[model samples]
Target: MESPPADTAPQTPALTYRAPTEEDHARVLAVLDRWWDGLGGDDGARQRAGLLPRLFFQHFTDTSVVVERDGHLVAFLIGFLSQSRPEEAYIHFVGVDPALHGHGLGGELYRRFFDTVRAHGRTIVRAITSETNTGSRAFHARMGFTEAEQSFPGYDGPGTTRVTFVRELEP
Candidate 1:
C-alpha cells in the first residue's frame, strides 16, 4: 500500500496521564458508565465504587492514570496489583472517551502503566479484553503486548465475552 501520503493521515494531540484522585472517581465512573452503553446506572455506579476499590484500589493505588485534554477528563486506564509474591500487576480495565480517541493517549497510558509496574519490581502485566473489542486488542498490540493466551469458551462476568490478552512486562 502506498503510504497514503503524510497529509492523508491525521495528526493526534498530546495528552497527560496522572493518578486519579478520590474526587476523580465520580467523573471516572461517569465516563466508564457512558462507555458501556448505559449498562451502568446510578445504583450500579454507587455499588461499583464500593466493590471496585476493595478489589483494585484498597491499598491506595490506581490501576491506570487519567487521560486529560484541555483540562477535561477525556479518558483513563484502570489496573491493579496481584496477590502473588514479588508483586505482579494486572490491568483491570482500559478505556477512552469515544470522542477523544485516536490521539495516542491510550498508548501513553500503557507506557505509563508499565513504568509504574516495573518500578514496583513487577515482572509481568496482564489484562483481559473481549474478543469483539478489536480496537482494544489493536491498541494493546501497538503498545508491544503479545497474545500470551486465548480463552474462548465464552464466559460471562464483565462487560461481555471476549478473548484474553496477556503481555509480560520487560525486565
Candidate 2:
C-alpha cells in the first residue's frame, strides 16, 4: 500500500465552534469523559459528567457551545443566559481535551461563548470553580474574570467551597 504525499493527504478542517444540539449529547459526554479521565480515575470522570447535564444542551443550546476539529469534539462550554438577570450569562461547565492543552482551544471556546452571549444583550458573565482548582482560577483570570465581591464557600456542596468569578461585558 502506498501512502499519498503529505500535501495531497486530506487536511483536517480548522477548529470550528457551534451551538450544542440534542444529537451532540453522546459525543459531548465522551469528550468530558476523556477530559476527566486525564485528571484521574473513572469515578471522578463520572462525577464530572454530572456537571454537564443533558438539560443544559437541550434547553440552553444557544448559550452553550461545542468546538470540533474534523468532526471530533475537542472542547465545550455549557452556559446559559440568566432569566432573573437578563443582562447576565452563567457558564456552568467547560472542558478541553487534555492532549490539546496549551493550544488555546479552551480560550477559543470561551471567546466564542462570550461573543454569543454578548450578542444577545448579556452584559455580564459568571462562572464558578472550586477554590482548590487553581488551573481553573488561573484560566478564568486570564480570560478577564475577577473574583466576585462575595464569593461563597461550599457553593457546590457540603465542604466544597467555591470561588465565583465575573466578567463585565462591553456593549
Candidate 3:
C-alpha cells in the first residue's frame, strides 16, 4: 500500500542543543553580565555575587543550556537538577539574547528542558523570578506555570519581593 503523503513542510533547522561546557561559561556570562549591567539599582547587584550562589547555583551540573543556531549563540536556559526529590529540576536562570527575545528560542529551550527532565523520570520543574519582573512572570504563566509562592522581605534590592513558580508534569 502507498504510504500517506510525506509531510511537505520544511523542517526547521535543527537547534544545536547541548549542555554549557566550561568553554561556554565566558559567553554565557557575557550575556548575563550585559543584562545585569543594564539594571538601574545597587540592591540586586549586591545580592548576586555574594548571596545568590550560597542560596542557589553550586549544586546543579549542566545548569546552563545553550541554543546555537547558524553556529551563533542565540539563547540559553540556566538551571540544575534538584535534590528535594528524586525527580525534579530547578531553573535558576533563562536568558534570550535581547536580539532574539521574542523569536521563540526561549520557548524552544524550555521545551528541550522539560523533555530532558522527563526522560530522566523527573516529575516536576520549578523556577523563581522577581515580583516586579512583569514580563518574565507573564511568560512563565503563559508556559502554564502558576504562582506557587511569593515573598517580600523588605530587603534593599529590587528582587527582594520575589515570586516563585512551579509546574508539576507528572504524578
Candidate 4:
C-alpha cells in the first residue's frame, strides 16, 4: 500500500498551554485585531484590540494563559485575582483562533484559569462582553456563568454597555 501524498497526509494538531510572558505582549496584541475581526469590522476590530493593554502581560503573567499549536498561537486568556475583591477573579479577555473556534480550546483556557484562581482562594470568576456578542453570552452560559439582570452602561466607555457574567467555583 502506498502512503498518502504529503499534501494529502493527515496532520495531528500539537497544542501547548502555558502562562504568558512579557515577551508575548507584542505578539498577542498584533493578533487581537485580526482575532476579533468577526466581532467588528476592520475599524471595530482595531477598537477591540485596544481593549487589551501591555499592562496585562506585564502584571498578570502569573494568572494568564496562552495556547499554541505547533508553535503558533491558537488561543489565550488573560485573568487575574481581584485586588479589591479578595474572593473574586476577573477574566479580562479571551481569544481563540477563528479557524479553531468551537473546538474546546476556549473552555480549556477558562478551566485552567479557574483552577489557578481557585488555588489562590478566589471563589468567584467574573467576565463581561458586549451585549451584542451573542456568541460570548451563550458560551458563558454554557460554561455555567450566570448573567447579571441588566447590562451596565458605560462599562467600557461612554456609549458602551456590557453584560456581566459570573461563575462560582466549588471549594
Stretches of candidate 4 off by over 4 Å are 1-9
Off by over 4 Å in 1: 1-16, 36-63, 85-87, 154-160
- What tens digits encode model 2's per-residue C-alpha lDDT throughout 1-96? 999999999886898888889888888877765575554355457557777777876898877888888888888888888999999999999888
What is the TM-score of candidate 1?
A: 0.70
Point out the higher-scoring one by lDDT: 1 or 3.
Answer: 3
lDDT (Cα, 0-100) at 147 in candidate 3:
82
After superposition, the stretches of candidate 2 with alpha carbons farther than 4 Å from their true spots are 1-12, 37-46, 149-151
Worst 10 residues of 3 by lDDT: 49-58
For candidate 4, the 10 contiguous residues with the lowest summed lDDT are 38-47
For every model shown, what is its TM-score relative to the native structure?
0.70, 0.83, 0.73, 0.89
Order the candidate numbers by lDDT, best to worst: 4, 2, 3, 1
Candidate 3 local lDDT, 26-96, one digit each (tens): 56655554555545365555454343342232344454577887776677677767766787887777877
Q: State in Å the error of residue 122, model 1.
A: 1.3
User: What's model 1's lDDT at 26?
Assistant: 65
Please, what are the lDDT tens digits per residue for candidate 4 over residues 4-44? 99989999778998889888888898888667765656646
Best by lDDT: 4
